[model samples]
Target: MRKFWQKNRKTSLAFLVAALLIAILWFFFWPLNRVVEAPGEAVNIQPMVKIQGKQPLKQNEFMITAVSIAPARPVSYVHRLFDPHIDIQKTNDVTGGQNNADFNNVQKVYMQSAINNAITVGFQHANRPVTKQYHGVYILNVFPQSDFKNRLRPADLIESINGQQLTKSTEYVNYIKSLPKNAPLKIMFKRDGRQMMVSGHKHDIVKGFNGIGITMIDDMTIKTDPKAHIDPGQIGGPSGGLMFALQVYSQLTQQRYQLKKIAGTGTITSDGQVGEIGGVDKKIIAAHKSGAQVFFCPYVKPTKTNLALEPGHQTNYQVAKATAKKYAPGMKVVPVTSFDQALNYLKTHQ
Candidate 1:
């Protein structure tokens, strides 16, 4: 064995080095069935939201926080092992069994809904006229077995079915239910601002009901008096809802954000409620890094019933507070269950 080692030592060393390089490459480049969610940037909301014919309020800054999500490599797991704020989620779970493109499409739809809700809430609070403008039903997901699976996409807008106009998701559902099983469907839809048409047959989405194998929601917009333009640009998610609403309200009411740099993440409903969002811990880290003085997090008062539903659960505010304590001790985290609560905090705390 010693003689053999002496004779083949150089070749053995070369082979070992090659193997090590391969393992490093695999760890670096190979994709996993997971994704890493980490701290993203805190974007200023002023420039992103513009209220026409209204003077923009000269406040410090109301910012929206984001969470960076990426497909996990083996090296990402190593990073997660070191970073407590980073989380690993299954790709299927994150995308809801859809491809990345479909996932992004759904996110864009959510963002649009958030913007509409924000406008409605802000206008109502400001005593401004705001009316709902329904365009059609938005396609959220397309099943693989559907006849239009290859032709339709998640972000497409279904304007009509069988020459009948569609203004709401319920209208689409009811119209589909009126048709026979496997009935031919002539769908008029819009994609990327261009009108398109597709011919397909309905499938049994439910056990007995026959319909297009697609999940959808109403495509509606809030037309506010004096107009408010919100261009989310590449930021696609409902997380910006609260901050957007805040910005809108601040401008309309001429009330400034008391804090120098305020950052937050929460979904805003049409009723002016601030709903809980994902990645509160990472959002706190991002807000702190952006020099934000305060961060508003969605909080739900834990009750016996809620606690019983989940064995061990912490609210977003709780997670944000803990994350701030450990990583961003200087930043202040405020718990708010609704838009009024958040506005009240800014009013009283300052």
Candidate 2:
């Protein structure tokens, strides 16, 4: 036994020395090597999207786009890896408690819920993608003719236009564009579960005309949830809530917001303001790593209070300022005080 132990002693010593060397190399040289060869390129270059030569947006021209809304969930594996410090739970909490009534908060929860409900129904019935969510840009604040007055309102779920079942807003716009001058068209919508139909005559203009006097903004909604339990009182306004809601809705409908290929952040209100979101710097870093080109910022007043206290207001401003300085330097930090701003922006931009 003594002879056996003596023979293994050298082997054990060699093993110990190798382990120590490996530890030292890992502690110093390995980390230094990683620092030298960082995972991604330091300088980020975005593709140039040109808005030149596009026709100037007209006030009476209605622009519409499809949006999806659904449940807010955990970030994907890629997002987590890029921003390991992201508090998804906190984000969810904030979204869940968002308020739609507040113009400043931008009614994200309500919109998300609307989209979720719609997607669930559409998926259960059609098993096809019903909408293509995109940012729109158009003119804001033009009233429709008296004949069309009170026929539409913000948050009204448009079911169809001109006998064409409208799955997306773009489809509706295209349908309207196809109609001839003085052609009578019927629009069907669902509001509070009551279906209503209205009729309007398409108009002709020199620039390939369509519908009369009605100026439409981009309309986005979250499908409504019939089963998932949510407290009515908990939801409050947060600027990026709309984008988050849409992402969730797209997931629930199995439509995939481009197979989760896209990532963005913005604040949504019930009234449709895309306000600036907090944690811009961290979110930008995370989004850039996740390959997000579009980032949505809610147009919120810097003085808005989260807790009716000075500390909360200060913190909100600090986060907003930091975000502006870090992630979206050249990007337009759209300041939307109402849904009209968001809708108009989407119309002209899209």
Candidate 3:
């Protein structure tokens, strides 16, 4: 009876070990339907922006901040539980039902658009000649009812509709609107640098008007007197718009505003408007960790419509200020409503 009891005890221990190992594996490997947002790196923008027939800025003061986004697994939950700074969000909310590859492609498009907008703003501010050249309509989103749903995706540049070769998205939409309902359509588009064609029929996407069941925006380039090249590496998103514009303006005008390490986050418009962006707290933390002395964030009065949409909403500057105060009290947080504001701030501080 003693030997039998000892054998049973050994078997029980073996079973317990196996169960423990399985639990550990599940805890680490199982995928979750969430994503983690953490503070990313702050990169100097001077080297990334190169202008022809001009000397590169010697000082690196402007920095572009990014937030690291990753799919959450079981391990990510553990990390988020322990780290208060990390944020967890629904994957659908972050990606808008896009897979990882599709979401990344959309981000790349946003980054390109931001660069072009920044170039336009910077060149105009520097008193340099800049011309806007419209390319084609860039597809941003496709609806489920669209016949080209599976064939077309975001980041695809629709070069023409019905072989009309429209340069502006508005023109494409107008042309489609004039067409008869359920009219057969031919779309010539470019994806991954390869020109592709799709045939479909326009549907009643709005007010009884026919549309391709896809949303599009204009794709264009800002041709400047001094050609500019921006190489952002793997960094994607429009959060770097303000910093890109600042760097471009500084290089073109040769203004030495590198008195201190300046880091910022905001999206730039062609007319120099600095739009608010997401992940302000994460960006501030990143800037602080990178030794930024001054941080610029978007701050503007809320429009009546915006206030109605989101009550008690905090502006990016407000969030950035609080984060900087808590994590890096030595850092100064400056509010900017437009690119000119940020530029003037640098000029006056210098």
Candidate 4:
């Protein structure tokens, strides 16, 4: 028996080595490719909200159907394998597969910077939201056809509209909408450290509605203590702005949003409501994976189906839906109209 066992040892060892190699290759390469090459699609969900007028006698308006999402780019399998921060093998075991955290973090930084540049350039040319002082907001770049050109830029803090003080995005939107059709409106904003004013006539894109073809974003202040160093690249778009603001506000003041157990994603305006974000589905997946129960989506919806459609929007929606359906089917996806709604949801759920 001993002689027979010794004789077959070499053959058994060779088979074991071959099996191990195959297993290692399948675990690392095969699953990595699947995660990186996953196909995504776009989706649009409309939100409903009621806007109250500043004056008692003025009639209130209901806002419906104004949000959209699409995929921007796909994360490749090679990218996930090379990620430095997260253990890709562990993630694959948990989610069937996942993107590498290092790759995602870098990509987020680039995307954030690009969006900021686009908004800056767009506001610089439109000549609206123009301020003489260089408040933090800088005009990055402008799209030729977008109505928002030269209206507002990155880092600019809107101080007021007309004579009214602007405290939130809803206030700014309502102020613009309340103007007399085609009437020249006064916009006051801070640039650098000084205050400046710009004038423009509101254009009516849809009948009975007035608008300036500008999209504005607030420049958020990054917080870091003496012991902690943060990378600027970590700053992304205004989508997480509201959550960051709430977190910051909670830290500074005693007012708690009860957000420790809750994770939310959305753009924030000054008025404190969560605005619709671009990568709702991706953000939702991230939130869910992070152990968050309630997901907040921006209340804004797309106006025209085909016109606002972009490649990124299409991809984001597709991946988001598929990921949600597969992972957190019972999780609540809450649509937020404003910061108030988000805060309320958090408080109630907590």
Among the numbered candidates, top TM-score falls to 3
Task: For model 2, state the Cα shift of residue 93 in Å.
Answer: 29
lDDT of 1 by residue, 271-348 (tens): 999988888888999999999999989878877666564324777777788889999999989888788988888888
From the highest TM-score down, the ranking of the candidates is 3, 1, 4, 2
Give the Å shift of residue 72 in candidate 3: 1.3
Model 1: residue 315 alpha-carbon error in angstroms:
3.4
Comparison by lDDT, 3 against 4, better one: 3
Among all windows of ten consecutive residues in candidate 1, which has the lowest summed lDDT?
A: 303-312
lDDT of residue 331 for candidate 2: 35
lDDT per model vs. reference:
0.86, 0.41, 0.86, 0.43
Q: How accurate is candidate 2 locally (lDDT)?
A: 0.41
lDDT of 4 at 128: 20
Tens digits of per-residue lDDT for model 3, 151-199: 9998899988888998988898789878887999999999989999999
lDDT by residue (1-350, candidate 2, tens digit) is 99899879988999999999887665544421111111121111111111122222222211111122222232232344675334333322333322333221235433344333433333333333333343331212224442455565444556666667655445666777677767887877765569888886766433564465544444443333322211223233232344433322333333322222233345443334444444444544444444443444444454546435433354433553455456545333344454444334544563
Per-candidate RMSD, Å: 3.7, 20.8, 2.5, 16.2
Mark the regions of model 3 whose C-alpha exceeds 4 Å error after superposition: 1-3, 180-184, 204-210, 308-312
TM-score for all models, in order of appearance: 0.83, 0.32, 0.90, 0.39
